[model samples]
Target: MRRSRLTLTLALGLLVVLAGCLGPLQTTPSATDRSTDGTTLSTTGTGSVDAEADLAVVSVAVVATAQSADDARGQVASDVERMRTALREANIPDDAVTTSSFAVYPEYDYSDGERTERGYRAVHSFRIETDPARAGEVVDVAVGNGASEVQGVSFTLSDETRAELRAQAIERAVTAARADADAMAGAAGLSITSIETMSTSGGFAPVERFDVAESAAGGDARTTFEPGPVSVSVTVQVTYRAA
Candidate 1:
């Protein structure tokens, strides 16, 4: 009777284990769903191209502090007008000068973990777009007129040039990816039959910074920079079906 009871317990355990395994087999994916067209070769490639910068964006601002908010705002406004006039006289078009920001806020001094209200501060910033060759001249004109702060200068390609370069960059990336895939397939004794999946992404905004403080301190002297070529880069991820 004891032997018969042990055999029955073992039979039940085996049935339970077999049922668990069969449950997963019922939901197994079909061969088509699990296939990758035999084998796949995956590769990523990057490419970059450089072109001369055609546009220069200069940031300048007028900052003022006074006992009252109204007084600070008036001071900043007056200086901004002066800067605008000087820029216009320097042949920068009115449309090229845009107000980037205008704000009047309270100034505070922190000492010994205590904050003290100082005064009101106002800031007016301008975004000036011009040719790369004349960027220095524009900066000088702004500072000499009324701009108290030279924010920064950046060189970039114009929209037309950027679009052209984007296409070239993508083409080069795809070419590189294909070359890598070919090499990989050949090494594995396989030939790439077709592309099973492909994706790409890339962009670039080349910036060469001109020291704002240095430009500001060089009083009456021309500020200049050799804005070098702007580069555009792109990357591609490709998965090729090989057989």
Candidate 2:
């Protein structure tokens, strides 16, 4: 009986030792160990492409003031109609011209620390989209036809052009990211086995504005404008695994 009990205790101790040896090992995180198993190199790459602007937007407003709001609004409406007619005659499509804003506000005059109602001012603003080459002509026509305020002119890429540029930018960004990863991996004496994760982001082109007077001077000579190139950029972040 004593020999059998000793044998059973020895067997149980051997089993416990084997279980401890076969268990999973735990390790703390380190610089190269971001994952549970820990082996990745992450980098961000950026690229940009320049494209010529194919379209332009011209903003104009017709402002009028009178003793009564009704009178001011009526005058502004008439002026806006005239401006629209001029734009149409200048070969601008009717659909391209749309009302942006219209408002009537009271003008205040403070002479002796007292607010007095001077008159009602009405403003009607319109945005016109056209080809870059015809931008100056459009502005000239609108201003000649009683457009009291010339907000500004801006240049931008058309929808189709923008989409094309965005695709190109993304492709370039990916290429750049891969090049960066290759360099990093080479330095570390490791080869990139696979891509663990990747993300992409797009950038918007800046709007180029033309310097024109607020109230365009009435003249026969058309205002010259320049539509500079528009640029689109993209960035990509890639996490690569090395073994």
Candidate 3:
């Protein structure tokens, strides 16, 4: 009698397991598989190129701090206006000056803990684009007008130049990938069978920095400036498949 009861329980467990497995099997396919055009794509190819940038995008931010948050903010605002005036005086186009940040925060004495607040800090950041020849002058003009705090400075290529460099980089990367594929085919004593697939890659954009910017300010000394030619570069990656 016990053996029969045990067999009956085992059969019940098996039925439960089968029911769980088969329940979801009856569901309809998801709606995503049906395309409006009733077509599917299965193959893809990608290529890469490398080129040097012809233009430089430089980012400069000016920051200010004071015992009073309001005073600090007011000072930064005034300085920003003066900075614009100075840039205009230096013949920088108004369109080239863009404000990236305007922030006011309480200066905190973290040593006392997050609960205690100290003075205030005000910051205004600007993005300026000028001829590579005039970048140095723009930095000087900005600092002379009241830029006391420097948060970060970086450089990039302008859109037009970047496109140009990208084209070259792509071509080079494709050539390289092809060379690799060909080497594989030759070692096997087979002509390229077919390009199974291809893909592209991109990496870090670099900024060429001239260190002379440090001389932009001193208590009694005027900042003299000079800008050098800017070089921009782009790298492309490509993967190719063989016959």
Candidate 4:
């Protein structure tokens, strides 16, 4: 009887050693884990907000061509001065008128596959910042004063407006994310216990661009532009713990 008891004890010791060598059992979380609120539900939501543009940047250029580079530059400079004077008369602040680019290059004409040097060309571009309501007036003022080219007009929000819109967009995105999480949890017969993790990303939308050259083509007619709303968008990813 003593020998039998010793053999049984040895067998039990061998089983424990084998179990140790195998390590712990591997298991995956399943429905039971979700019931115990150990599972996470993740969802992504997006939001967009549109607001009327309050600021406008009008791009105007003065171009001149002459046989000599000096002559062309002189002409362009004179034209730019005239435009600046006009803008000032129109009540545009001096700080609002800024030079965007100035260049002097040789002009070429390609005809019948022959390239010929036409003349030296000078161009001076100006960016005039103003309110959207005055963009048309500003364009007219520049054109009447010697601006030969109207590049386009960009309508966008001011810094304060952008900040306000961004905040509203983010709030909308968070609300959307919570709604999605709640919907998904409810569909699965679970309730969101808490938000485990969340991340957000957003940005200001593209500015509205308008070309007023066609509208301004009518002689003696005032140029006008109606800008649309600029948008702000945001996206959020949320992970919720559910039971």
lDDT of 3 by residue, 1-243 (tens): 999999999999999999998785565667896643321112222344334334444466667778898898888888888888988888888998888877899976766355667688888887777666565566677787776644434445667766666677667656655676666666765555445445555643545656543343555444233323333333334333443
* Maximum-TM-score candidate: 2
Q: What local lDDT score does residue 167 receive in model 4, on the 0 to 100 scale?
A: 88
lDDT of 2 at 177: 91
53-111 per-residue lDDT for model 1 (tens digits): 99999999999999999999999888888889888888999999999998999999999
User: What are the RMSDs of all candidates, in order?
Assistant: 10.3, 6.4, 14.1, 6.8
Candidate 2 is scored at a TM of 0.80
Every model's TM-score: 0.78, 0.80, 0.63, 0.76
Question: Which 10-residue window of candidate 1 scores lowest in summed lDDT?
Answer: 211-220
Models ranked on TM-score: 2, 1, 4, 3
Query: Which pairs clash (backbone N, Cα, C closer than 3 Å) in model 4?
Result: none
Higher-TM-score candidate among 1 and 2? Answer: 2
Worst 10 residues of 3 by lDDT: 37-46
User: What residue runs in model 4 are displaced by over 4 Å at the alpha carbon?
Assistant: 1-37, 206-219
- How accurate locally, in lDDT, is each candidate? 0.89, 0.87, 0.62, 0.89
TM-score, candidate 1, is 0.78
lDDT (C-alpha) at residue 61 in model 2: 93
Error of 1 at 68 (Å): 0.8
